[model samples]
Target: MMFASIASVALERAQMTRALLLRMIQMAEMRDPEETGPHVNRVGSYSIEIFEKWGMKHGLSEEEIDKKRDILRMAAMLHDVGKVAVSDKILKKRGQLTEEEYETMKRHTVRGARLFLDKASDFGEMVSEMNHYHSDFDAMAAQVALNHHEKWNGRGYPGHVDIATGSPLKDYAVPDYPHKALGKKEEEIPLVGRIVALADVYDALSTKRSYKEAWDEAKVLDLIGKEAGSHFDPELVEIFFSCLPVLRSIQQRYKEPEMPSE
Candidate 1:
């Protein structure tokens, strides 16, 4: 009886921590109108769906996958949290950015990664105090933030830095650090990062943004299919298509407000 009571309290506290983290993500992204909606929620949901369908093929047991699902959902939200640091001029620009502006924009990936890594110990302690649950997910979340921009072919950025190595740097704004290109191939990227990458791209392509109308769902899927080996994990792409119905249902449920015709 005492054990049950302790377990219940732990679960409640964990829930609270998750809620707080998600709210933080929303607040961080509120600067950009395009990101202020259900974008984070949809990406998290889409990642959950993808993992549910394909996690086992990656060698995780059903129980392990189930345990990690919530963590995956929450961590996915922070994938773009570094955008908070980007300038409004760039983030809200309706036109394409100049080369310099685009380069600056990519710094968000590294910035977001640093947000978690820098605070990992503190975050772990807080979660432990709140829920008495020991979770390594803070580190995992940092990895997802760092690597979500990485491509299967290794072309993505802020490119190929081994973020697992701790840094003494305190200023998150300055991205000038020695980040070596480790030359990671498809399987080398963390599985969670790969999953969120696909979800992020899918949501971005299928939804209307300030610069463009939403592409037709068929076109989006076709592009994702075509980019399988180079842009995405081919096996995960198959899993994505195999679970099309659920993905569509998720899309409809989180349907963005329609843009007025120009």
Candidate 2:
């Protein structure tokens, strides 16, 4: 094959990656109006900013930090992509989810992870070889999607299950969720997943939702501070606060466009 043909394939591969993320986001927005493009963009931005600082504190090299941060920016945006499979009734509900609905809702984490898991590894050489980090990218993205909902205290949903088959990866089942694997806690949750988890919730709390008003920064900080080792990764939480100004800049950069006056 001509060298030009090979280069064209590489370009197509990159475009394919972008297309996958954007298309999935579009589908999800159709189901849940709140998962807007801008919301995902802010979450991605927050994740990388906080993760970079955490990496520096932990002694990761600069190159390693950027690589992980770049992958994380794209992956974190898809953290809620699985909501595409949920019913409009559940996703659009303005009130509390019923017990069964909540169980169904919890499946989004695993389902989102499933979107990028096993199938991604089977890409034919024509596409697979186009990007050197193809396998690792998919794996990291899958893990982010899978575990972003997990808590530091192991109370997170759809935890520790095989992404491919939804079977328990381990025997850890919670009393409230006997049918599925329990979510991971603290060290068990991968740092990558932990980073996005913190980023996603920060955005959710600070951003206005159908049932809630946008909270001021002080209120957001209080709740996050109180949940340090229970809800969020404690150290990441510290890094987040340390770089509060930067995170606010990102939040402003992606703020929603105002509606036109009537």
Best by lDDT: 2
Q: Which stretches of candidate 1 lie over 4 Å from their true place?
A: 1-5, 120-125, 128-134, 162-183, 259-262
lDDT per model vs. reference: 0.78, 0.83
lDDT of 1 by residue, 148-246 (tens): 887898766655554544222333222454333433468878888898999999999998887888899999999999989988888889999998898
Clashing pairs in 2: none
**lDDT for residue 252 in candidate 1, whole number 0-100:** 85
For each predicted model, how many residue pairs clash, with residues at least 3 apart or on different chains?
0, 0
lDDT of model 1 at position 160 = 57
| Whole-model lDDT, model 1 | 0.78
* Candidate 1 structure, TM-score to reference: 0.84
